[model samples]
Target: METESLVETLEAAGLSPYQAEAYVALLELGTASATDVAEASSVPAPRIYDVLRTLEEREYVETYEAGSLQARAHSPSVVLDDLRSRANRLEAAAEEVERRWEQPELEAGGASIVTQFRTVIERAESFIEDAAHQILLSTTVSNLQRLAPALRDATERGVSVRVSVHTDDAETRPDPTLFEGVCVEARHRPLPAPFVALADRRRASFAHHPDSYDRYGVLVNDRTHTYVFYWFFLTTMWEPWETVYEATDPGLPTEYLDIRHLVRDLRELNWQDAPVRLRVDGYETDTGEERTVEGTVVDVRVPFASEADTGFELAGRVTVVLDADGERVSVGGWGAIVEDLEGTRLTIVDAPTVE
Candidate 1:
């Protein structure tokens, strides 16, 4: 039974039955001539030399000569090590080819749907593995646990990973330590029914929770629907108020009610004809210089429901334009970051010139 199992294992590892039997015969015999190997194993005399020669080439056996044909089996450890190295080289080559290969444009625009829970999990894993730039995941703690390996792989590759963990009930909340060092940014938010994953803002997957046992999900590659998911994920699911970065300054206060009112009042100010004067101060991100300027508010760009195109998609980003010291300057970041800046206050200097 043991010999039979060995033969089967060797065959599964790409060795021919004749090669497997001959190699095992040599192992048992300690050393053997070609004819002796054929007698001890099932390999025909005519093919035994070829089988042994092939095994020798694969590092599974070594050839020897002592005035006649001889063969010896290498230790299994040495043979497996060689096979593992070869497999690693093949995997690296495959990755390089995939990296340089251009995918043919699909007629369906890459849109797909899977109606099985297992398939949904598989697709999500594939998306995470193929991520190049960024990955956004909004899921419950239970689902995040399933995807931990793939998420860790993406983070190790330097992909920016942002996850918003949620819960169906308060008692099932996530363990914060599970996400440590595996995500660039992570936060907790109310669970949005159904799980969502967006990769590179170009592809997305949505699926029902495994606990529901329902088998259905979507793999969206159509640019329009993918963009819709991206917008929704960034705007609603990953809202700034809900996002609490681990690296964010903890010393900063969390109260923003007063700032919100201040922003609203600033926007409501009707500087119809004349520019509204204001004071602004913040460090220049590029130069690291302390910048302070008193100038008229050229434009107050707020993230509202109805606004003209300003090249920003997420809400709550309030960009203020100012003509400071005769130079038009524009600055904006996350609402929290922008509002938290030191010495950033707006005051009416010359009110509308009395219109």
Candidate 2:
């Protein structure tokens, strides 16, 4: 390296500017008087003596009387060893930074904002691996491939996984075969969308596309906070998209994260007068008491629908009426208010036969 660059590097490695300059000058000089070192380096003449003294104290140089006070660069071995040690520390620090960026830990019960998109992806992979009930995701085909293994593992464990793939190009469509055994359902969205992964209604990871001017990610571990992203994924990236692939048969007993989904399926069964049983797990809306209600589903109610009506509304009130021990009880989803119970997990213990 050039003398100036070397001087700067030395300063970065824990040397004063004057000390670095004087040391470099003395190395070139072989052995020189204080006056000669100052002339060769940019260190001020008045400060050269103090700089040389400090360097000698730090063992970068040796000073002695050679007619007059003279200074010489210490053996190259000592200086080189220190520089190499600093270099090793810098390399290790760089690796640590990359590792933290790739595997950031999000705190529970709150949201974390991160600068790197990879952090969101890595966190999403971990969330998928730990998912117990459901996984909702929206991403490009390439990212789907990256997360396929995790998604497959989730499915193998009976976790419901839904994926929506989006791209800006009209002709660029993801192959339907890519989702087989990986997810329960896969949809094709004809617009560019942000990457989103919501697991079990408690954790969510969202990231803006790399092409966007402002790139960042949001990781939510709170159920209330994650609910906001769940609706975003549903309304924008999921609901309107065309289904590219869906499992031919999602055999019983099925699990649902949202009461709306459970109601949708229950509506069909109700119309057929088919007997159904469910295990509803949630907390009481008023008492805040945890309860598990398992019984036959007697009726389902929506805002503008009757028991005779089979059509379902996308928005508004949805309640599942159950008969537990011949006593009628109501179950609702997420932010349930009108219903008695705010259901979190709904498992259809016995699904009625459908041709």
Candidate 3:
């Protein structure tokens, strides 16, 4: 390193500018009078004595009266050790910066904006690991591989994990075997899509594709915010995609946190004339009063055309007509207004008994 840069580095390592310059000069001179060091370095002759004395106190130099007061640089071993320690600290700090850039910490109960897509993926993995009931994830096949372990663990714990794998084309689609045990179902989307992960309706992670003009990510722990991302996943990445992999039916008594999913399953069961019983847990839409209703599902209604499946459109109503004892109660999903009850948890209490 240049002498000037060496002096600057020494200053950064806790030595004053004059002390650093004087020490550097004495090292070069072998041993020098205070006046000689000032002439050799940029330090002023008037301040050289005090600067050398301070360096001596710091053990960077040993000063003694050699005819007149003289300063000699400390052993190179001691100085080199201090410089090496500083370098090691700086290297560790650099690693920490990169780690935070990739896996930034997200605060609880709100949304955070981050600059790296990796941050969203890491947050999503954490949410998947903690997921109790359900997970909806839309990402590239490579990211699917990265999160496979966490998703598999969630499935082993009985969490419903649905993955939408986006690819550039059918030619680029991954093998179905890749998702066999990692998720309950895997869908193939033939277009580039933003990464999204929603866990148990409460936490969500979203990020634009790296190719996007504005690259960023959002981590959300609020139910309300995640609900929006859930719809985005449904309309864009999920409902429209073709199913590539589905686990063998671990048939009934299955539980659903999404009323839309519940409605879809009920539609199929009703077509086969299967008897469906449910334990509906939620709040009364009108009064926000909690209610649990155990009944048989009599009807599944979606306000679109009779033949139309509940696809991306959310403009119409989707209701489950439940016969509770003698009274018929209309149950709806998250933001239910037309229905009497807003269902939060729906468990199929009876398995299909179709012949």
Clashes of each: 0, 0, 0
Q: Which portions of model 1 miss their true places by more than 4 Å?
A: 12-14, 32-35, 49-165, 170-191, 194-227, 234-321, 327-355
Backbone clashes in model 3, listed as residue pairs: none
lDDT of 2 by residue, 172-222 (tens): 989989999999888999888899999977999999978888788999999
Tell me, by lDDT, which candidate is best.
Answer: 2
- Give model 1's TM-score versus the native structure: 0.45
TM-score of every model? 0.45, 0.78, 0.79
Residue 314, model 1: lDDT of: 43
The best-first sequence of candidates by lDDT reads 2, 3, 1
For all predictions, the C-alpha RMSD in Å is: 10.3, 4.0, 4.2
All models: lDDT?
A: 0.66, 0.86, 0.84
* Model 1 clashing-pair count: 0
Candidate 3, residue 280: the lDDT equals: 85
User: Per TM-score, what order, best first?
Assistant: 3, 2, 1
